[model samples]
Target: MSPEFATRYNRWRYNLYAPVYDRVVAAFFAPRRRRAIELLAPAPDERLLLLGAGTGLDLDYLSGCRQLTAIDVSDGMLARLRRRADRLGLAVDVRVMDGQRLDFPDACFDAVILHLILAVIPDPVACLREVERVLKPGGRAVVFDKFLPDGGHAGWARVAANWLTRLIATDINRQLGVIVGHTTLHIEHEESAGMGGFFRIALLRK
Candidate 1:
């Protein structure tokens, strides 16, 4: 889809789901996300950046970190994230920024997390490239998302999954690990969870 079309669709779906977004998403991905974060084990004082940080579901769990910036495109989602931050008494600077055009300096952050984001992004390659560009030398990034099966039934399955996801959000089935490898990134850790050949949490570096 065109960028203009994709942006409109994304904003529309997110606004439509804002009322029940937290309940619906948390019920499905919370457990897996917690496990992924544990596996990543982000260190203190690291300049961490969270992309597509919907409702701050992972913010509470990120208390051990020093400085953090959470960015998302949806205003409705960001509002909920603010509330979540208030409730937890945490100070996470929030912004409504495009993932494909990060408004930050190069090598400024220690870590960047594209949690559950790439799958739903309209332009996965552009998004990943931006992440790579902003990452500091030897900085790490963790990508936790679902994609098509590696080989078995991948061709058709990926297409179908992406088609359906477009009704709710824009998601592609390309494995983030492979995509990262194709870019200027190195994989550090990788894990898969869930059936239906979906979901993975991978740690990568640039």
Candidate 2:
């Protein structure tokens, strides 16, 4: 698919899913999200960005940080995020923006939070490059998503299933290491989360 088509597809798909997204994903991914925030440990007054911040599920975990910015392509999703943030009495700057092309200055943020976005976006490398660009030197990013383990092979079943999954939400076979390696971010720590190591949290530094 063309880049524009892919971006539109994701935006449309997520917009369709926005109403039920938190209900669908929060129950399953809550633990991993909490762990990721714990690892991130955003300090007060630090500027933090959340890429593809669907439904603002991570906002509560970020209570300590006063400055929070979240971006997503789907206006539906971002709208829900705004409501959630307001209900929680948290001040968040939520925007309808593309992850692959961040409209931010270099080294502008102290940290970035990426949750379940890499596999969903059309260009993971470009997204990571933007993450690196917006992050200040010594700043960290907490990433939580599903990826094929490094050096591991995808079985025939997974390869076949990915075709359908990619049509709706995510690519099941993306290799996290390869995507991260293409950018300037350094992997500071990594650990497996969720079932059978299917999900992982990686702390990356710029």
lDDT of each: 0.79, 0.92
Query: Per-residue CA lDDT of candidate 2, range 1-206, in tens?
Result: 98789999999999999988888888898889999999989999999999999899998788777999999999999999999898988999888899999999999999999999998999999999999999999999999999999899999999999999899779989988999999878899999997788888999998
Backbone clashes, each candidate: 0, 0
Per-residue lDDT of candidate 1, residues 95-153 (tens digit) = 99888788988888888877778877778888888888888899888877877545534
Pairs clashing in candidate 2?
none
Maximum-lDDT candidate: 2
Query: Using Cα atoms with residue i matched to residue i, what is each candidate's TM-score against the true structure?
Result: 0.91, 0.98
Q: Name the TM-score of candidate 2.
A: 0.98
State the displacement of the C-alpha of residue 19, model 2, in Å, after optimal TM-score superposition: 0.9
Task: Tell me each candidate's RMSD, in Å, in order.
Answer: 1.9, 0.8
Query: What's the lDDT for residue 206 in model 1?
Result: 83
